[model samples]
Target: MLFNLSRPPTALRRSTSEFLQLCRQLPSARRALYVTSRSKTMSEPKVISVEGLSSSEANVSGSLRNAPRVHPPALMASVAILALLRSESNKFPPSTIIIEQYRPPVDRHVVGLISEGESPEQTAIRELEEETGFKASGVVQSSPLLVSDPGMTNANMKLVTVDVPFPENLEMPAQKLDPGEFIQVRIVELAKLRAELQAYERKGFVIDAKLDHLASGFELAEKLRQPKSST
Candidate 1:
């Protein structure tokens, strides 16, 4: 389900400051207002009191104030694809692609968000193809919904890994990026994932904690894939 904020009511719009003050007096009322606004699309504007919002919500509100519109969901959910492309000829080791894109209220960064009504695997395939022009064959692993930023937004992200086959000398497909979406797909060796993440951090990009955790899990999986030696 998606929650959206529309324009404010006439009375609420008349005095934004007064509405906020009232919100501070009644937290339940504030939540109720949000519930109503999000339940259905509002043709007329719906006002919300920022005073009653949590710190994270307040921050988001502040960021959107200058913008002409704001539409935030009540419970945000996203999916990240850990795509692995391997050469069929074994000429090259398997590598994965991570995206660099611009995120709202923040500078350019590395992350991807799943679209609504799409399953994690479907999101994985769609995002992979759109962002990197590679189609995933199947999902190898999937993570439960993990909190992205508990303090700020109630958004959660699920991570999934899918296998991508790239035969030798095959031409890559063209990427289909969304409008205003500036994405750079960087392919890195599986073993050098940590170093690549660190490099991104050094460049002043806020690395998503979920990505770090997912990378750790991938590292463990790689280690486990190694054949056990006879004692």
Candidate 2:
């Protein structure tokens, strides 16, 4: 994240001059600005100088402003499927796809990147089948478009819930993962989801943020549905 500015870039030099001028307009503004920006994300502010700035700096200053918006690359976009297994006992438990892989140092949900020319729902269905070996009859619910780590990256995802009918033989299907993908599927009761995630964490396995949030929401809803004890 460090930027070398020995001979500062055109935009940077112009921005520095403009910022300094604005700071000098008010009493003690320069000191305040220096402390706020430097102490937070910057190691040193000495590289920023307003000593020699041309009048043309004003014209180019407008271009230095951050872009109004950015579109995430389609290749980086993904879909996460929440697959619920419907059993004969009328219990619809959700299956958590634990990714035991090399890259993420932790476990994740049933998620896959949207391939070229593929829709979000299609990606969801394919991901469920490939990661957990369960075919989604249909999408039960679709969440709003979500952006994970907005501060860091603009990558986006769609979360869809699907119902998977349990087989009569009660045997889980074999997973059809892509090359080098290692995943384990577990059907967990909704009530025990949070506890299961906590247990995984205790065993030195970190839970994905999105999955953790889902489990926490379930736990919160269960608590709120219970009657309060009398004081």
Candidate 3:
């Protein structure tokens, strides 16, 4: 006796025929078809329903349910410039850094985002000049990218340090700010950064984590620069 294999349903056959016709239009479709066929052949049949499953299988299902879900694209690239500006004063230090006080959508804070088609260093230089009206020499240090908040976002920040020269006779340029931006550039002493940050925090301004890290880095660098006294 001869036996015939069951044929696929008409709808499935039609769908397959249409898919094949569409695939024929593309050159790489044959490779895709081969991969799909191989995958399907290698894959084991999975029982989706929890009913009548073994304890191990049920546990596996539960684990799958608790698995971290892959979120959509919410990652963003940001830049924070720790700008050092020259001060022409004998009493005070010869240089002071600039930090901005700006409001974000959630709260009044300080941070900056890098623009498209611009490097981190470029973004820092541009933002520093735009916010403070000072053109400065910039250097992109070998610093690791920091995650703003690992739990909430995949956003990473690039911290850049820019040094600006302010000679007594040097002309200051006009600030080029965006229409919606309301930024106040404050000259901050590196030694008094903690106090300054505290003062800002008292005024309902939320400090960006990147700024805190940058400040800490500055302090550490200063400490390293201090000469050790010989015993």
Candidate 4:
């Protein structure tokens, strides 16, 4: 479900000094505020003060029946596509044309958040076209929602793969990025994806977790395909 972040109530408001004093007063697990939809505006947020409960019990679940848990109004989810194109030039050894891009803050794959009524596949196709100007009829594969950082946030993403035909003439495709999107596209060879990621990191670019894991998967597959040495 989608959620809109709003300010907390005035009663719950506490200054930095007041909060520090409260922490000193409470000698139990840190106090946490869990957002819940109490009404239309979601104004009724429950403050779960686990001053007596143990660390594990602090995180409420259905098992508790009455325990209150933090449920954000909206979940952070997106679709990340691994768009691959087969080049006609190197049909012998097989070449996978991986479309990547670099923007401020990080180097990431073609990704975007899923709109209110759009499916994951639709998000992938739209993002692929919008970010790289490459159109796909549909995705080749769509994986389940993969959590990017469960410990930090409820943010997750669906990994999708789309296969598009690389232009035989090897012409660079144009991007149709929205305003404020200064994305620099890079066509990295699949065989050297791992190396390219390392090189990108060396240049002080923060690599997205999805892209890093994808490159590592390729490297692992390559090693698995290699023949073992004789004993």
* lDDT of residue 156 for candidate 2: 67
lDDT of each: 0.56, 0.55, 0.50, 0.55
Off by over 4 Å in 2: 1-71, 74-76, 91-97, 104-110, 167-170
Ranked candidates (TM-score, high to low): 2, 4, 1, 3
lDDT of 2 by residue, 12-54 (tens): 2224456456545645312222211221353433212112222
User: How much is 213 displaced in model 3, in angstroms?
Assistant: 3.2
* lDDT per residue (tens digit) for residues 1-231 in model 1: 011111232222323355435545654213223111114454643322122232356446433222111333333355667777788998678777766543333221123554577677787777777767878889999877677545444446666778888777334677886544444556777778777778867755656665676568778998899999999
Candidates in order, TM-scores: namely: 0.57, 0.62, 0.53, 0.62
Itemize residue pairs with steric clashes in candidate 4. none
Q: Lowest summed lDDT over 10 consecutive residues: which window, candidate 4?
A: 1-10
Candidate 1 wrong stretches, greater than 4 Å: 1-76, 106-117, 169-171, 217-231
List pairs with backbone clashes in candidate 3: none
Candidate 4 global Cα RMSD? 13.7
Candidate 3, 71-109: lDDT as tens digits? 312333666666665556433453444444322122112
